[model samples]
Target chain A: MESERSVVIAPEALDDLIGALRRRGFRVLGPTVRDGAIVYDELDSASELPIGVTDRQEPGSYRLEERDDEARFGYAVGPHSWKRFLFPPRITLWRAKAENGGRKIEEEPPNETQLAFIGVRSCELSAIAIQDRVFIGGKFVDRDYAARRDGAFLLAVNCGEPGANCFCASMDAGPRVRDPYDLALTEMLDGEHRFLVEVGSERGADVLAELPSVPASQSDVASALAVTNDAAARMTKAMPQVDLHALLAGSLEHPRWDDVASRCLSCTNCTLVCPTCFCSSVEDTSDLAGVETARERVWDSCFSLDYSYIHGGSIRASSRSRYRQWLTHKLGTWVDQFGTAGCVGCGRCITWCPVGIDITEEVAALSKQEEKSHAATA
Target chain B: MATATPSELHPVGAFVPLPFRVAERRQDTGDTWTLTLEPEESGFAVEPGQFAMVHVFGVGEVPISVSGPPERPGDPIVLTVRAVGAVSGAICASELGALLGLRGPCGNSWPIAEATAGDVVVVAGGIGLAPLRPVVLHTLAQRDSYGAVSVLYGARTPADLLYTDQLEEWRSTIAVDVTVDAAEPPWKGKVGVVPKLVATAEFRPEAVTAFVCGPEVMMHFTVQALRERGVPDERIMLSLERDMRCGIGLCGHCQLGPTLVCRDGPVYSQADVGALLGVREL
Candidate 1:
């Protein structure tokens, strides 16, 4: 099955693959150059892919740089993730209308658009799986998320060129596409621009049978493995290997929180760009004459002052507390809630933050604080 | 892909509200109101500490405890709300026969069934009495099952007290002690905080299962009083309040430490959440 599953295709064959998906009633979505940054958008052809593109990312900064070769999927993740497609930023939950004597309530039907997500990174796959735990894996399923997830097709791309902030190697989430993807692609640029395609599922095999492809030679598979291995080696940032949950649980009063709060804007950029941050709030609005009403679920951040609002006031009124809540929940308490860490080491939180508060750096600081406190007690 | 069946598409998975009509409405105080709601189709039975997400049509929803007696499932669902926010204000203003939306009977309930043959101490502060009202009533209904039962209630003032008539009537069967933070003329009961009343409550600390609900500070002091009285941490229970959008626990607003207060608890033993309560602004 290993030899039968591996195949190689020319760069142009990507067009036929997209065409095949579209013919099968899937709206193909992939990375494209949008507003000077690579973003996921509807794709009609493979030419729309971000070819000859790479990204340079640092804390609080992101920029698109021209690559020396035309290799698609040559960049780390951007601000936009597949979360926007799965758990939309805003969706109508239900609608209500004033009827005779009583109100008539109607729930919004589950979204049924079949989506073929192309170029899904390994970390992004982990993010999706984490959200799957959050929405559908719990006692109550988010029907919308379940429907969208059940019908979607995943086309994972193994990372070949990791960015400055890439740390999926440390989080054990990626650089290699080992998650449950329909088809995994590794772009090779040794003399010829081609993709080594590995069929990950029966559906992936069916799709490959329709496309013009050949069995992958020993060299082809080796080169593909080397691409991801090189990316792992190129990673510069990493989360320190420690019991992060205990570190955070003991550092609730650590002054490092105040330090981050001073630099933190509480702008919610990290949460908004986060692929697995699932916090949301519901809003109810009515039309004029108070006849028709709709309830909308919108993406909400814990950093927002009102996110923790109760009857009297917001429980976490201070910026320090709110920042602490976001970080502690993402890296610490998230494991207890969903059996996994919320952060997938995607680095979007660090790259997109306005103040450039690097989560990795903060955790390192917290670790150092923990060591210092232990030494003092000793 | 297969489409969802009718049962799979049920509103329970989508957080959709079921229609309920306000069968009875009574203003408990100047700002608080107790509403009895009847389901238009099927009714939901709730345990003593369980709560419901009461919705006011165009207005949003808020988590309110089931204030009605748990023994009376045939009776309409009772919710006592204070006009503190927009949603609660709309619920408080709901008139009799007004249609509203409801979801849940969510979160864990008080362990009254487990406290049989032991004393029970029910403590409430201000509007906090609404959630614990069921515990006191449940104890009264099964009077012989428990050794001793007491209800210690406190409010900002006599004007802010809820269920005044019910408090006097409950005195006939159980020990009901009411206190005020401060009082004006004609006020003639205890004049200290509610935790002080815990000292004179008629319950043996060794055999007592204490249920407490109130403002965070008040609950903190009350739990301290219970601890000083030798009540085991596991036996002291409290209901928590937090911002919640989905009462089913997906919204993540009601998270306290590792627990989603909406799912893991609105009611928790002191031994479970004591350290978290001590964390400032947690």
Candidate 2:
């Protein structure tokens, strides 16, 4: 509102920019090279970003590829994002020490750091929005997820280049953010040295005020648009969810599941890599002395036998049923249950799957079956 | 439409490791322990068939049925927990004064309101009786409020009947007909399964509501027994248990068809889950 929140920064402005954020005392969490993938971690400088580097991805495969040109964020999706900052994989629900016959209760603190999640992708924001529906908009709410989500600052990045596994364009979720972000940074790699930014929040405007910036001419904005368009058009994967809820709803006896089950490793890597998957199990443990104790909510997966157990037996006993449950919930019942598509089409599950079980390919197969069955009846 | 009203859903939760003064611990088997917890101050009188998510502090919580009657007001309720997971394993090792976290008395309970006038047959198997024990106790307390009542229970063996002393108490009053898959040398009661007993029992199905809880196999046969005896699906109730990680209903782990066992039920009419039974491995 004060003039503009937009602060156009060149590639060289990254280091000083990180220093400014650090001086302001924000624990800046952003992307960095880790184990052959871009992962979010504590960063102090632009050097942490994989400059002149990009990633190659596919179902069941992820590899690093050398970038022909240098750009901090010249690529699309990464394995890490704001999710880890908000919904931790494991968290302590209760802590207690010995007191007489019962354990005395202990407490956990709320977010201790002023978190600034940098380099958030548009699709990731969509995932976050979906998670909001799950954690904050239900009959019962999750206090911890709310605390982490509410006070944190966001810095979303529109896609400048599509990864081989990316299908956000097909899902109509990304490349350019339709909405939801404090500030959206559009990387203009075509420029000799720079990135163009658009601020979407008042907080973003104030943050931009302290950074060295100048008004971008119309050409800069136009070039930024071109880069995003190229990324959207170059996307390697495509998924159609048109009437997916109905398709899945009607697919109770779909035989394509048997095909998928035969190859699925039941490794749960897909759920682990997925940003929105949030099934968790509660754990309670005690010290041998019986003096202290704790309860924790750790991530759980449907692939595990223990995930579904009653006094008698597991309901979804077969791997086929487990797979069917997960697929149906993700694409079908989720809409009836949560009123939103459970997937963001970011394609992390594709690249991380060890057996290369592609959700897009699976949906396409199901859609194909629907057409075939319709033809058979007609 | 978010199933989980996240921020407010888990309204009061924080696993606090506290020494749960183990008021008592009864070893039900090599892998099962019936524990009675006394809330540090004055334990809440949880309803019949209600459960407490028992936490071993650090391990996590599991829904354990309260086996004791709530009429005593603040008296601790009994929990017959089999050592199937981490929490159960720790509770099996816990002694009096061991600390633990308590989450709730959640999920829909037995319809104590509707089971009036008509006779009620409470059938349970193995540790499944723990969840049904409260209903049994409440029925006995207000004996005049309901009609003729009876309890039929079975277990893997003679020793598996949880709360044996309580079984004797109910038996001494009327009949706590206990059965087993296979009777032992010392076995004295009926040497058959629960559903078999139901088939031969003298209860009138037309004037009764049979609440059955057991291994799906046992319940499967029991449902058949009631149906053959002319009991309508609506008159027969069952406790449908599944993997209920987040009892608040956000996690899709326990969804069965259009219902979530965590929220819509741990209790359901036969008609509610019959479609699920039709699907293989549902």
True contacts kept of each: 0.62, 0.50
lDDT of 2 by residue, B1-282 (tens): 124433343445423322335778889776888777776665555666666667665566667777774455466767888887766788778887665556555567788779887888888988778888878877887788777788889988876767788888887554577888887687777878888877766567788888888877788898898899888888788887777776777666778765677767788888777666667765
Q: Which candidate number has the best DockQ?
A: 1
Cα lDDT for residue B11, candidate 1: 39
TM agreement with the true structure for every prediction: 0.98, 0.85
Which candidate leads in TM-score?
Answer: 1
A152-179, model 2: which lDDT tens digit per residue? 6677888987888888888778878865
Give residue A293's error in model 2 in angstroms.
4.5
lDDT value, residue A83 of candidate 2: 71
Error of 2 at A71 (Å): 2.6
TM-score of chain A by itself in each prediction: 0.98, 0.95
State in Å the error of residue B271, model 2.
2.9
Sort candidate 2 into its docking category. Answer: acceptable
State which candidate has the highest lDDT. 1
The positional error of residue B267 in candidate 1, measured at the CA in angstroms, is 0.4
